[model samples]
Target chain A: MLGYTITQWLFGILSFLAIMFALMVVFTRNPVNSVLYLVLTFFCIAGHYLLLNAQFLAVVHIVVYAGAIMVLFLFIIMLMNLNADTEPRKHIVTRVIAGVVGGVLLFVVVGALKGAEQLQIVQGGASQIGLVKNLGKVLFSEFLFPFEIASILLLAALVGAIMIGKRDTNINLK
Target chain B: MTAFIIYKAIMCAAVFLLSLGVAAYATLWERKFAAFLQDRKGPSRAGPGGIFQPLADGVKMFMKEEIIPNVSNRSLFIIGPCLFMVTAVMTSVVIPWAKPMMVGGHMYDLQITDINIGTIYLLGVVSIGVYGIMIGGWASNNKFALLGAVRASSQMISYEIAMGIALIALIISSGGSLSLKDIIEGQDKGFANIVWQPLGFLIFFICALAETNRAPFDLPECETELVGGYHTEYSSMKLGLFLFAEYINMFISSAIMAGFYFGGYNFPFSSELYASLGLQEGDWLISLIGFGAYFTKIVLFICLFMWVRWTLPRFRYDQLMNLGWKTLLPLSLFNLALTVVVEYFRGNIHF
Candidate 1:
């Protein structure tokens, strides 16, 4: 029954790809390659959102993460001229410790998720509720204050970053 | 169900091929239009008034030697143009090309798919188009190409803000729905949205020009300065792909502009004429006229693109940035506020 529907198939494939890309994002030696892998992971998650019928979230996730944020990351990585040759190899003990810690983290996550298969997932979660009109109504009516606060927080962060980055160097001689 | 799927498959193929053909012919038209503006004959030797020029040009692109620089990243260099072409083609998916077609007592929607978040999908696809230029420029490992890529991504990213804001005003006017079909139908019930969204249209047109990298905002690939810009190192079909993608973008942008602002195929007097002819809706005759009307809108906008290209000088890069950030951004925000206030007064908004 779980394998019969297209949605279940898509979720399986996308989740597999997402996890694979997430691993690749960390394991890739080249920063640009890592960024590209992260982009793929973002796209996979966006596909999962679309599978859940959250089209708005899917598009916004792509627009914000893959389109903008990852592009910025790639820009910085490219500007820094990073490549395999430039990468500093980590110490063997450090790598071993990281492997152990990562293994433990995976174990805990897998343990936590072991029972998830037993839980019944809805085939569709009220598609109309996920549409833009109802979402907008819900956001504005119930979550209006939180949305406004989030905007103000982002605005403050943007201004602070600008202020921190701006310099007043006036000592150039031609 | 299979028939329905087959119909959609046909519509997809038709839209894809239509975009490709339109982009090819648009190149020929651009040259011819330029000739008209400058009082010269342009490529008449190929066919009647150079009608076969695009075909000839395409053959040449295929026949030319494909060159990849030794220093360049080989796979990415190959992938760049392909991605550019793919993104260019993808934007057309959200644009509804025609009204429903009736065949064998079944109504088949003439569009490929009418996704709910059509405008957002379009904007997302367009925003990602920057990657094609960025990767192409970067993979070339050429300084000029890298600079061109940087300029492309920055320009597209900046202009997209204004473009999004301008479209927000349209969305407000359309009463918060992002479906292009609904918006076009809404305009059909009234005057074309251009009447009410004139400022939005102005900002939108300017931003569209910027987004497509057309003059006077064509700094990304401006030939004189960058020597072919991002595609400087590319040759043969790769270069053709890069260049062809621009015309495709132009065609799609025109279709978008027509769909959003000019009421798409909702030509003024067509319905009256159809009523006078005693033909019901979804008749083949009406569909033909409506299809012609939609293409007319697209062709007119395409001509406007050519007109501006031939007329206006390219802007300096700084001037381009300044216009995008200082002028268009603030103007679009003002348009947004104005629209909100007006809609409030018109009682289109509750609370």
Candidate 2:
């Protein structure tokens, strides 16, 4: 019981930290600072995954979001080299509306979670069975078609990203 | 009982302190190694053989004035090194230092944590390590730093795909087990996985070296071009952290390489040797011996890392990109195909 409470306390603190960092990511005016905070936010999410016994997911989360995606965002921000002077200021009314919408979204999420009372909560050990090996088996066997489709989607996204990033050139259109 | 927890805590503390101490000394070693390579004696006045050089260097770094440029992003500049150190150290948790032992009617493993997805977790954590360099370079507010960060990020991304594909080949060859423990166990009985997947091992080793930003792929910190690369603006302990984190990462990657490809703590005829020694099942001493074997392997890999650093030359940026994308990627794919075919012929395909 004591162990459970300790784990819960840690989880709560981590979650709070994650949410705070995420808010900071949005609120920060500096794009570079915002991306850094987003990395922190992703770290907090990874912590949550750890708490949930999804070690693989936690690591993947860090690798993809904090490592790759955030680095790319930093690259774009640096490439543009926009400073505070170049940033457009948000009006007071717009800020207030944004705050209100953020609040409503948070409330709705919390309310929906609260309403899901009948969900069966499995303990850590029981859920540990579906670890990397089992997950791979399911991913390859049961969801092979969907997984292939997902790969195709990722390829499309990659091509799209490259196309958008390419410089405009004086060439004949197809 | 409580003593076991204390023992574990002490062990963890020892490994942490030892790694840091080693990282500090690695600077001195690098200097000496480089000097020797150039046919000159390195610093020898600090202490006997300049053994105290790292201490002197540490003090000097701490005393140095930390210059924060007015235009620099001060907060991120501060946070960057801290992030690097944290990510570097975190990957050590899942590494099994030794085998499990029976203590007080319960089994205890020598690792801090033994998650089922140990290898993937490592992959994931290493992937995030690039952010530390990116953040530092960007926060410096210098053109050189920016260029370094851009190069570092793209290089990391390009190399990561090949690294992941190499790992996929290993995973396929190993019958889809992602747990480092299982992989090590599978490689027991004097039949290491490297024998089966030599190409995969080679690919993974090269990628590992590149991932840790060691020499030959140390373009991010290349002095000739980018003037200390991403860390040009850093000073004092912040700079120390970045440098120290690199060594720490080197050590971790070496340990990981040993664990995955070198059969970890297992040795040929280990079971027979244990039997001859009259070591019964659940013997803590046997586990200790096993752990020692693993530690020795890790140390050897570290020495190899240092040797390679001294021997290799840095790769050109275009060459690095081409090697990662054109060469390593296609090779890994071919290896993956080979693994699949072998498994299929053996009637051992999991599907």
Candidate 3:
């Protein structure tokens, strides 16, 4: 009834659910529940990517974020044996400071978006840009340098992680 | 348009029933095969060679006492096996079962959807599959379940990397398209990807085993230690769902392996046979034969899975981790590089 197409309706529903889940992530007291909510939020965002016809990006987003990173988050939360009862309470002053920091961040984000133009949904024959072949061509030809740099950055992080992990083990063994 | 929609609805129902039926029989077959290996006859009393055994098992699972632990997270406990079964069934959507069938001047695809990113979609769904185990285990509030959940997640994650890398090499060789249809078509015209990509196939097979939580990597639900593992607290139909989902996953993975490595629905000299038999393209009989070929490959792979399950002992947890990280990861990486080099030399890919 809003004069929206099916895709547009889907977009609105996904966006609404995304924000709801994102809010739940912050509101949930249990760390595991928080992580799961965040995962739901990520899935909603990925749904938006799919609606935008970015199939590769949508699947990769779920694989990398919702699948891999959130699993690690769950692992840490589960392994640490943290529960609402075991969760340490912050002092009143500390809570106040954290709230102030979060508010400021939100304010900054809203301020930055205040002057942005409204985005138009591109409708027609499905966009080719999101398909794997075209995306690969664009990535390798135009974005090659930036992509390589990103890979190098990731390699550095990997090396740093291994070194840190090995150092402690070495000390313990010695 | 209505006809097309009706066709798709029928196709979906068929695939759903097919997966459920295969899973049911797989359980019986697993028992029969295990019996053969151990020098005993498996369940022969029910309807000749235990043909109705799966039905009996279904009834048993349905009739068992439903129990939810008092301390367990009620909602999540209910959600666990349901999620597992849902994800298990969801993966078959993109798989092309057989060649398209022509009806009333239209060629209907046997697959539910042929998305271009089919490979990654499989990986994504499989990665999400771990959540079912994780949530189920965590909701149980039992230490054993928690440990099993942790192992399942870690093991699946580790093996997934190798699996994706191994698939990358295969994709590079078998046309760069990510669609399963394209990969299968590539094989239909030429040799199956298995000839050149044996090592890649082996790596993928191993990773699939670990990902599906089959034996040798079935540490997540190993009975000796964890006493049912992630499904320890699950009872009756809930436990049945978890067990049923594993067989479904096995069937799907076997179909995928058949599609990826073996010529999916394309036996050797199939076109020659078709031409000699004077069969036209899109003929129902041809499609049926192609489907028979596909089914044979899947059955063979399932047998191999069952054979290994009965043959090999379960890997120690440390050894499983070591093999996934230290061995298969590097081996798959090597396969990727090797495929790239060979493809480049073959003039199939430009630098």
Instruction: Using lDDT, give the best candidate's number.
Output: 3
Which 10-residue window of candidate 2 chain B scores lowest in summed lDDT?
B342-351
Model 3 off-target regions past 4 Å? Answer: A96-101, A117-126
Q: Estimate each model's TM-score.
A: 0.96, 0.87, 0.96
Q: Which of the numbered candidates is closest to the native, going by highest TM-score?
A: 3
lDDT of 3 by residue, B1-351 (tens): 888788889989999999999999999999999999999999999898889999999999999999999989889899989999999999999999888888877887888989999999999999999899999999899998888888887898999999999999999999898999989988998799999799999999999999889998888667877576888899999999999999999999999999999989998999999899998888888889999999999999999999999999999889999999999999999999999999998888887
In every candidate, how many clashes are there? 0, 0, 0
Better of 1 and 2 by TM-score: 1
> What C-alpha lDDT, on a 0 to 100 scale, does residue B107 get in candidate 1?
82
Tell me the docking grade of candidate 3: high
Q: Whose DockQ is higher: candidate 2's or candidate 3's?
A: 3
Which candidate should be chosen as best, given DockQ against the real structure?
A: 3
Interface RMSD for all numbered candidates: 0.6, 1.6, 0.6
DockQ for all candidate structures vs. native: 0.81, 0.70, 0.84
RMSD of 3: 1.7
